[model samples]
Structures are given as C-alpha cells and as structure tokens.
Target: MSVLTPGDWGIEALWSALQPVWPGLSVELVDEIGSTNVELTDRLRRLAVVHAGGQVPDDAVLPVLLVARRQTSGRGRLGRPWLADPDSALTASLCLPIDRADWSGLSLAVGVALANALDATGQHLGLKWPNDLCLRDASQPLGRKAGGVLIEAVNVGHRRIAVIGFGLNVRHQTVPDRPTGALTEIWPEATPPATLARVMPALLQALQRFDQQGFAPFLPAYAPLDLLSGLPVATTDAQCPAGIARGVDTDGALRVQQGERMHRIVSGEVSVRAHATELPPAPGH
Candidate 1:
C-alpha cells in the first residue's frame, strides 16, 4: 500500500466545496482506521457527555468529514464485514447535526444523490432499494454490489447528530459467488481522493434538501435507478415472504406486491434478495 498525505486529497479544495452546503464543516484524512462510521459516532457520543455539563464548545456541534485510507474492521448493513485493501476503496463518514422531525428516506436520498453525481445519465450505476449501490451492464443485468451506505445517529443535549458513512470499491475484486464492481469500471482514472471530491458536494446538498423537505422530492429521481423494481424478491421477514418489488413509497419504505396485498417493508425490518425463484448468474459463467 502506498502512503497518501492530506495534500494528495486536496483537503482545502474539498473543504471549500463542502463549506457552502455545510458551514464550519471540517475535513480530515487518516492513513488507517477501524471504521469511519464508528469513529464519527463515537465522537458524537463523547460530545453528548460534555453537553450534560452545559459547557459544550462551539466546535462540538460542527460537522466533520472523516476519510480513511484503509479500514481494518469496516462494517456494512446487518453487521456484515466490509473488507477493503489499503488504497483500494473510498471509505468516509460525514457527521453533522440534523434537525429533521422525520428521518425516513434519508438513506434513499443519499443513494439518489450519489448515483446522480457519479452517473447523471444512469448509464452504468443503479441503486438497490434502501442503501446498496450496484453496477448495471450488459454482462450482468441484475447488478452487483459496488458500494453501500450506513446511517447512524446520536442525540447530544437537545440536538441530534447523524453519522453518514459510505464505502465504494475502487480497484477491488469479484469473487466466485459474490460479484463486486469498482469505480475504475466507470471512471478509468478513479482514485479515493478524486472520487470523494466528485461525490461530497452533491451528498452534502442532498442532505440539506432532505433535512428541509424530506424524501418526497427524491421519489422521481429514484425510479429509474431502482434495481429491485418489478423483480421477484425474497425477504427475511415472515410477513412478506416473497413479492414483486413495486419500488419505494413516498416515505422510502419498499412496496412489494404480494398476491392481492401490497406490503410495505421498512428499512431495518428485513433483508431482501432479488430473484427469489432463480439465482443470478455468476460473472463469466
């Protein structure tokens, strides 16, 4: 693995681009960490303790952008391990105070914004329901996991702070059963720093919009990029065993058609798998 300094990431330029969307936002890059999400969440938890003393510092509530060049114990949805080689993936977390009453669809909004920012035309990138980012190509129409989002929040005093973490394969791999996609496939020259610069601004803006208007505005934008739409899916929830995905509702809950009943599967309720009756073909099979 090669070493990368803060200069390589252009912290100053990234901070400038993100400052307009989130004032007082700070950016920091580290050589290695356990997990960006865990780090940010822990920071807010510690800050919450300070708030109880009624002597919280001004910077305590300010937003921060933390990037890790390599993650030793990265995590995904359902506590799945997210493994990435040093300099082989882009892993970052953004922590900021959120004042929204209803936090539903926040992950979907982030997915839509990232998909648009990376591929505005929706040529090769697609979103899988709540939080997974997949690749769409002729070789694999069902799409493969390229990245994902994890949102966690903590209450500090009277304010709520959200830690939004994401990780994307840069020059990764495709195993026999678990296929993966990389940023290089879409952008031949993609690197961690470059990729972060491309998506951060749009992500920050989308978060702001979600905080104000909620997820209703992102419904239209999420339609075409939805990977589970019109596909037979199986879920872990006993209530909705199998159904054809009808896409997500206004609140970001997944709508599945089960017989004559349309069941709504909220995030964190169950894990979904595409093609319940048939498995997707492995790459080069």
Candidate 2:
C-alpha cells in the first residue's frame, strides 16, 4: 500500500480497499461535515421511520461508513469539542443495527479493536478505561492521548442501532487544554485514509463479535492494554471518593477500590492523576 499524504483521502481509494473486506458495505466521503456521528444518527432515524412505515424490510441491517475530511463541530464524550487540524485527522462514524440487549462495554471493545489495529505498526498503544487511546511507554509516566471512541445508541422498534465515532490524529496538531499525541509521531507514514483502511474492518468485526458475546469475550484482550490498572484514580461523581483502579469487571463497569469496598462505576469521567488530589470539577460540579 502506498503512503497517502495529508488531505489526500479519496472515496475511490477507501472503497477499493474496504469493499473486499466488507462486502455490501456503503461508504460515503465528504469534504467537510459538522460531525459524522451526527449525520449517521440522523440517517438512522430516517431509516427507522421508513421501516416503521413498512417501506423497508424489517430484518435488513443498514450499515453505513461515513468519513469526513474535516469536522467543523465534532463532539466527544460529555459534549466536549473534538477539534483537529482539517484533513490531518481521520474522523469517521460507523452506524449499524445490532442484536444485543446489553450494550455495556461496547466502547471498551471498540478501544481494544482500535488498539489492536494500530499497534500492529510497532507502536505501543494503551487504552484508558471506557474509550481513550493513548501512546504509552516506560519513559512517559502519563500516557499521551492519541484518539478516542464515542458511542451512541438509538433504539428502533426492538432493535438497537449504534453510531460509533472515531477521531484519530494522523499528524501533530494543537489540541487545546489537553496533552495530545499523533500516529505519525510514531509511524511517520501514517495517513488518514490508510489508517481508516486498517482500522474500519477490525472495528466492524469486533462489533459483530460483541453483539453475540457481549463484553465477556474481550476482558482478556483488554487487560494488557488497560492503562489505569493498579493506579490511583478519581471520578466525576462527587459522592464517590478517590480509589485505586482495579480494572473492569465482567459487566464492563469500572471497578475502583475505595478502602475495603469496591465500587462499580457505571458512567463517569475518570482521571488517574494523584492519589487523593481531586481533579478540577467538571462543569456544573
């Protein structure tokens, strides 16, 4: 595969590479979008309406892969702005119907899949619980954030649709208020289209496996890449006291050891700073 330059992503190139891997998959490339996640969510809503009206087959799964060269208003977890240099980041969303009742740990599963795909290039990558991809090494105590996964679920009739969004920095760019890392820093040949080509198939396969087995099948795979294991951590939940990170349980909830008690945190922003020092409170406290 030839190395692609920055801003050189092409629909034809992406389709040619991904079509054989994912038969019948639909791909859309746009010059710019507010957010690929938002676009796919809207499309899924319209599809649900059409299905409800009996215009489309009920059992049909609408799988869409949308990629954007630039995102004007990309969003991360908790509605935080996901800013990246135009054409220098691989911003994409995958929307598909799944047959799972329990969606817990899907984000973690995605993180594992992404780490597996990128780590093949000889970069040691680690995952922060839930879904933050980081470049980790013995030299750097705190891992540098390289990418993230944001998942949103929409229920249509008895089926659930997932919109999984990915934002990976292909090149170094200024990310305000956070320490950022880029794939090109480790693999200088990395490019948006090439990175997407490597990651999308792995992600789709992982999602399918997760729908059938849930997060149980991914625990062992996630353990090695878990960056927060055996570390002091704090959470956005004010009532919850600081605790030692004990990895995730079978159900995907983060397990934090607070004194003699273990707390199963379902959802919150977790930080691995100092042992008892609280992180600056999130907006609205």
Candidate 3:
C-alpha cells in the first residue's frame, strides 16, 4: 500500500487532469465543510434565484463538482451520518441540471456507473439496491459496505438540479459503530484522489445518460452487481413485510416476493437479515 498526504490530493492537480475530458467543467475543493450536499444545494438555490431574475449569463454551464477533504456533518440515506477520517475517504458531490420530470431511478443508475468505474480499476464492487457500494465475500454474501451515494434535488427556475453525493473509504480506519471496508483492501495502491479521478468521468457520463434514458438502460449492466437478488430481506419500515429479494424493476424498485405475490418497494432501508433481528452496523461512508 502507498501512503498519501493531503498535499497529494490537490484541487489544481485534479482540475488539470480532468479539464481535457470535461471541458469548461467547474470544480471546487474545500478543506472542510458541513456537507457537500448541503453546500451544493445552497449554491443551486442561489443560482436558480439569479437565473430567475435574469441576472445570470445564458452561457454558463450547468454542472459543478465539489470535493471536500473533511465533512463535519456528512449524511447518508434515511438521515444516517456519514463519518470518515479526513485522510481515509473521498467525499464529493456533483450539482447537475436535468430536464427529467421523474427522477425516480437516478440513484440506482449512479450506483451502476460507480461500480463499473471501480471495476475498471481492478476492484470488484457490488450494488446494494438504490445506492450502496459493497465488498462481497462468500461468508457474508450481502457484503460489507465500502461506500454509499445520496441524491437530492433542488429546483432551479424550471430546471431540476440533482445534487449527487458520494463517500468512499480508500484506506483502513476505525469507524465507530459501523462495519466499514476500504478500497485499499482490494487495490492496495489506491488513493482518494486517484480513485476520484477514475470514477468521476464515468459517473458524469452515467448521469447524463440517465437524464436522457432513465434507469431502463442500466438494468442489464446492474444485474451482475446486484447484491440483494434472491435473498430473504426485511425493510426498516414497520408496516412493510419481509420477503425474498427478486431484484429491481425497470424503474429501480426492489421486487420482493412475499408469499405468492411479488411486492415492489419504491423506497426505504432494507437488510438481508430478518426484520425482527438487528442489522449489522453499516459503514458511515
């Protein structure tokens, strides 16, 4: 494994490498923030307000990327806190304007894109429905979570901007009350910046495609990486019953087989373990 200092993950270095591929793309790197998602949301709101008032130029590009060395109030799905060591994780968020009226399956599409990108770097990552990246093992087929994605939308004028946030564990570190895994476990030489450079382009491409084609196009590619398929699982919601996981639908809903019927789960936290049992701690990232 190689050691990485904060100096190695410079914003200018990343921008220089990415500019050719993503021409005119804006990038910002901060030492610390409450949350990238929160920051981007606020920015989008201000942009929308300016655009609405016709005070902004018409030639401005739509997407902006923000990377943070540390997050004081990082968040995950269902309001979970995403905690990580400043040097051990890659935390980033992208604010992108979209034309889609229904953004139902964007999270699943982003997961597929990220999994493909990591695979290109010689790491086998799996998708745990909606938006979790997993490191699967034979004994723990559901896999230990290596990372996660959270997508939030803000309306800017008539456009909807999706704030896509991701947190990936790059090196080994202790995460209190969570079963976390790191990319270094597979790619020992991986660094936060190196991993980001590899994944960002793929993620951007996927988001663009998703804005045009929705989740249907990524269904086939996502199947091999789907970790919950054919497993008995339970939902976090008390009213939802436990069932056997049957993979996702075209719209990214989890299809769970309950008794003689198949039920579609559009949203909620799920676990492979029975509903009554306690779920293993998940990675804060």
Candidate 4:
C-alpha cells in the first residue's frame, strides 16, 4: 500500500483547513490532548468569553484545536495506550460546547454519529461500545472493529466543552486490521485520501446530531450493527467475564447476560477471537 509523504500535524494547517469551514474556529498547537485540555481548563479558570452563534456572552468557548504529529502517550478507555504511528493515524481534538446536565456517558451517542458519517463513505460502519466504529464482514455473519473514537470533557469556569477525538486507521489495516484487506489479503490502490477526507464532514454532522437526541435517535440504525448482540461472547469487563451479549442499554452501555443475571458492561478489553481463522467463530464458542 502507498502511504502519503506524511503531512505535519501543525496547528496552522489545522486552523487553515478548519477556518474556512467553521466560521470562527481557531487553532492551538500542543504535544498531546491531555496537555491541551489542561491548558484550556487553566485559561477557562480566568473567565474568558467565546463568541459563538449570536449575542456575545461572558462565556466565550472557542474550539482549541490539537493535532499531534505522534502522541508519545495517548490514552483510551480504562487508560489503554492508543498507540498509532504518526502518519498511520488521525488524532484531532476539537473543543465543542456541550451541556453539563446531559453528560452521562454521552460518548456512545457520538459513536453513533460517527457511524452514520462512516456509512456515507460507502463503507458499512457500526458502533461498538463507549467509543468505537467497526466495519463488518457481512459474509462472515458477525462484523469486527475497524476504527476508534474518543471523547473527553474540559470544563472551564461556566463553559463546558467536549474534547472529541477520532483515531482512524485510513490505510493501514493490521494491528487494527482492515476488513476488506483481511478478507482479500491484497489492496486495490496506493492510498485512499478521498476516503479519509470523508471523515471531516462525518464528524461535523455527527456532533450536530448528537446534541439533539443522544443515542435514542440512532438506536435503530445502531442495532443491526451491534456485533456481539444475541451471541455468546466475552464482556470487555472481567467483572462479568462469562456471558452473552444482550445488546446495548438505553444509556448505550453493553448488556450481557451472566448466567441468570443480566449486567451492563461499561468497559472491557474486547476481542472477537484470537486464532488462525478466516471465518467468524461459532455461535457459542
């Protein structure tokens, strides 16, 4: 596969690309999202107003953008290391204003939003837990993970912005494995920037949809894409290690039946199955 001559993840580039699209979007350079949020929170403590929409108020929440060349230390749920080569991944943080009252695991809804955007790229994508978008192998019956989405909250004074990030493996499939390449074991082209570019519009649209209805609006679309639903599987959380996936809870948590008890799995290190096989495992493996 052909990899692009790696573009620098500079603040200027991010600002340049976003300024034309987001009206008043601004850019900030940082080593990592964690540090970026820290700095944002510090600035917010002083009470700064971000002018957005209409009628400028005391609370002006601007989107402090962070694009890393390569995150020396990146994190996912339960602090999993989100290590991806600088060029192989897309790591971006956009500070967006959100309501505090509805901050109960709202990331799942974002996953659904991202999934809807991925669907427009001509690839069948689905949502998987707290934050992940997976591409399914339709012929294999059960689908698998293809990419990931991560969201963080940065509360500064009266402004609370969600620091949303997406780590998408556009070209390289292994480690995260590409569904098409794994099935075919051969690539069709050098690289796919056109496909990757589709993410920008997807993200913008998803965020807008998320604030309106949370996951309730996307449940019908998200259900069929549920990979482990109705299947004997392992929960990402070891607390309920042995159980079958019952699907997601109303709040977007994974539901698994452990013996006679049904428990909602908020987190777990998931794996479809680790072995040498081209086909999905049997129903009750």
- What is the C-alpha RMSD, rounded to one decimal, of candidate 3? 5.6
CA RMSD of each candidate after superposition: 5.1, 5.6, 5.6, 6.8
Top lDDT prediction, candidate number: 1
lDDT for 211 (candidate 2): 90
For candidate 3, what is the TM-score?
0.87
Candidate 2 error regions (>4 Å): 1-22, 50-56, 59-61, 121-123, 137-140, 275-285
Give the deviation of candidate 4 from the true structure as CA RMSD. 6.8
lDDT of model 4 at position 236: 50
Q: Which has the greatest TM-score?
A: 1
lDDT of 4 by residue, 75-157 (tens): 66666656545455555556777654565446766666556654654256655665766666666535555556666665555
| Per-residue C-alpha lDDT of model 3 across residues 131-232, encoded as one tens digit per residue | 899887776766778999999988766566789999998887787776767888888888888888889878878877888889999999888889998777
Q: Count the backbone clashes (under 3 Å) in each candidate.
A: 0, 0, 0, 6
Q: How does model 4 fare in lDDT?
A: 0.55
lDDT at 193, model 1: 90
lDDT of 1 by residue, 236-273 (tens): 66888777778888999998777667888885433355
Instruction: Record all residue pairs in model 4 with backbone atoms less than 3 Å apart, i.e. clashing.
Output: 49-60, 50-60, 50-61, 173-177, 236-268, 237-268
Identify the superior model by lDDT, candidate 3 or candidate 4: 3
1-285 per-residue lDDT for model 2 (tens digits): 443443466566666766675566788877789999999888777767867845455546667898887899999999988865565788999878777889999999999899899996434788898889998857555488889999998766567888999999888888767777888877788888888878887888898899989998999988888888777788886656577777898878888877656788889889875536423322222
